[model samples]
Target: MGLEEEIQELEDEIADTPYNKSTEAHIGRLKSKLAEKKEKLEQQQSGSGGGGGYGVEKHGDATVALVGFPSVGKSTLLNALTNAESETGSYEFTTLDVYPGMLKHKGANIQILDVPGLIEGAAGGRGGGKEVLSVVRTADLIVFMVSVFEIDQYDRLREELYKNKIRLDTEPPRVNIRKKAKDGLTVNSSVDLDLDEETVKSVLREHGYVNADVTIGEQVDLDRLIDGVMDNREYVPSIVAVNKADLIEPDYLPTVESELEERDIDPEEAIFISAEEEKGLDGLTERIWDELGLIRIYMDKPGRGVDYEEPLILREGDTVDDACRKLGGSFDERFRFARVTGPSAKHDEQQVGRDHELADEDVLRIVARK
Candidate 1:
């Protein structure tokens, strides 16, 4: 039988089987097997030269992939946010290539990519989905665009990305494994876990772990455990942007908000905008800035005042060392100490070393060795 057929059979069995303590291990094995088959199939397709993958060169401070179903205002949103003139229409699949656009906000150049709208079976290489998803995997953040009236498309779009091995808005499972020549499998967990040791062993064995040491730091479900075992998944942060807000009346706002609530998305958290009319776009840009976690650091160059006009941009949690690296050349290697006067510093002009963490709008002066 073909690998796809085998995958289908496994999926059918897993779905048809009843779940309980008695069958938990059995289900785990089935899931592990299913994941392996899917991986193999994907590898096979890639080796056969499936379709063309969009050549998306990451630009600016960070790259954001705008994704959703066709004709869901993704192109419109891209045009509204950046200078890219993505062809927009009232029909599906208007964007056949990955359109690149730059969104400059708060002294940072953020690249926004308008990818082709995803379909139901896109993850399975349908309609050249593997190529599109490949580009998305390279992005730092995902901007999910959906029509205000078709908020349900959010779930479908997310599912397609999930099936393509993209884990949105979630961190990777903290499951560490060490392979051993012998002595059988050993499982250790720091916290109480739902899946017992035997079930964990069963899943690991299915993934070809004959003798290994497994350490799990958190209580993980079956899917997470499988994710931990596999290394092909991409974990990305995503935000929902409901487009076509201008078309909806104020009275109908509550209805749309309720639909967002049904999808477990906080209505207040989701950005409602009219990409066509360019309404609520400021809020959307703010969301992108916040999500990207980009921070601005004003450099205090010698004989030069703080360059606040053209401040250096970095990600959150960046340290003095990272700032120096961004500065490039001799700044990192010849740096002796840095003085910071901002939110990250304890006091104004506090002298710090390379390990000092920087905050947004921090005035930084680096003193290097002569």
Candidate 2:
């Protein structure tokens, strides 16, 4: 049988199997096979040009994908938030191509993409599934734009993204697998794992690792372990922007917010806005800024203090070496240290090295080899 047929058979087996201690190992092995088959199918699709992936070059300090179903005011939101000329209409799939826009906020240029609308079966390569989601995988954040009346679409959208290997609002699993030349597969866990050792070994064996060492540092389920084994998954941060809020009644806002809340979605982070009326856009921009978690590091000169204008934009938790590399060419390799001031520095101008982590609003002065 073909890879697709094998994948379907494995999926059917996994669905038919009852979940308990007895069948857990069998189910895990089936899932591993299923994942491998799907990966092979993806490879075939790529080779045959069946999945013509989107090719929008990443720009600005960060990229945010405006994703939703058709006629959800994504184009309008794109135009309202940035200087993009994406066509807007009151019909489905108005934005056919990925339109790029630059939103300048808090001294940072954030690139927002308005891609073609998604639909049901998008995860199965329908409605430009691979193309649209490929762009999403490249995004630093995904702003799910849903209409006020179609609030339930959030769940469907998330489901499709999840199926596409885009783990929204989730961190990477803290599981590690090491292959050894000898000894059977040994499983070690720092925390309580939902899957037993037999199940883990079965999954590992299905993935072509007959002998290996597995370390589970976090409380993980079977699916999480499989995700750790498969290295192609992308974890992205996400937020929601309920568009066309002006059409809804003022009293109805609470119901919408409550719906998102009941689903464990943070209502406080969800922005209610009308793209046509250009309402609540500042709040949306602020939310995007905070979600990106960016930091600014000002460059300091000896005896001249910090150059507050044109600060180096860096992500949170970036080190001094990262900052040096951003400056380009041999800076990181230069034989010298740096002087730091601000929250990260103990004193006014403390001497630091490449490994020093930088904080927001910090001032850095590098003294390279003479």
Candidate 3:
């Protein structure tokens, strides 16, 4: 049985154990520790190397994963982004094994994994499902793939996550646009035209929000109007690639563009691409890296007579205070200040307190009097 199952079994046995007043208090503490350990085990099992074969491979420093449904250009995109020489085919299940590739971006090496395809009933071992599902559960971020041709694809993806009880905290992808006039504007990729109250009302009518006074600067109650239209999943900050854009006619592009705008989806966030043809792949790669929000920092060795490198190596979080706390009470008590260099530091001097947030590519020199 898995560690999780074993933990659950132990919990059941412990609950049934005869407990006096004194033993009851100790039982609670033991249960809490058991719960914490179980959570950590689950986290490890989800990632490759933690327990499953889905551990994050270290490239230079950064880690990334390419995730999506089968035949959604996931492997193709991975090959393009990393040049990993992974086998790519048109057929389903071409990539049975997970493939790891190194992608260099912004002077940082990012390890990208092309995970196996997922289908319906995956969580329950349908089509060798549990394997791929477990692999994805470990990913820091998922590159959710969808074809532009599939109507209501976004909604379907959400339903699948719901079925598995996988809660995703994705921030809604949106763009801020300032309107010159109070009247609503019809947003297009190339041109922005005035969409008066009448046009807004008409669009609302089509969505069944009839007789609704749709006006600019007025709060449009999203729930009262449309059901299951807006994606409630916390936006994972993604760049939308409208794949197979070339398949549709030129004239239809405007209509698709307008529809996306009506939904408040940013046109800039949407990239027109043909993954098969490698068209617009460069732009897509740039967008993905930008949205990932990663920074790489290099550490330098401290000079002799005042060596602090040993204790600083234990630091994990991107902050001076975090580094101090990791050194235990000795460093914390003797902690005078921290001399931070690189991006986050304001000056080339010792920083005052612990609240200073460290940035990527920062070289820090912590100060403590003996």
Clashes of each: 0, 0, 11
Q: In candidate 1, which residue ranges exceed 4 Å CA deviation?
A: 50-53
Badly placed stretches (over 4 Å) of model 3 are 1-62, 170-239, 246-249, 258-264, 298-317, 321-337, 350-355, 360-363, 366-370
lDDT of 2 by residue, 1-370 (tens): 8887888898988889999998899889888888888888887877887656576899899999999888989999999999999999977777777899999876788999997756645667655667888898889999999888888989888888887788988899987899989998999999877788889999899999977999989987888899988867899999999999999888998898888887787878788899999999999998898899888899886678788877888998898988998888777667399999898999978999888999989999999875
Number of the candidate with higher TM-score, 1 or 2: 1
C-alpha local distance difference test of each model? 0.91, 0.87, 0.55
User: Could you give the candidate ranking by lDDT, starting with the highest?
Assistant: 1, 2, 3
lDDT of 3 at 242: 69
Q: Which stretches of candidate 2 lie over 4 Å from their true place?
A: 50-53, 301-305
Candidate 3 lDDT at 247 equals: 83
Error of 3 at 258 (Å): 4.8
Which pairs of residues clash in candidate 1, taking residues 3 or more apart in a chain or in different chains? none
Per-residue CA lDDT of candidate 1, range 313-342, in tens? Answer: 999999999999999989877888999999
Q: Which candidate is the best by TM-score?
A: 1
Which 10-residue span in candidate 1 carries the lowest summed lDDT?
Answer: 117-126
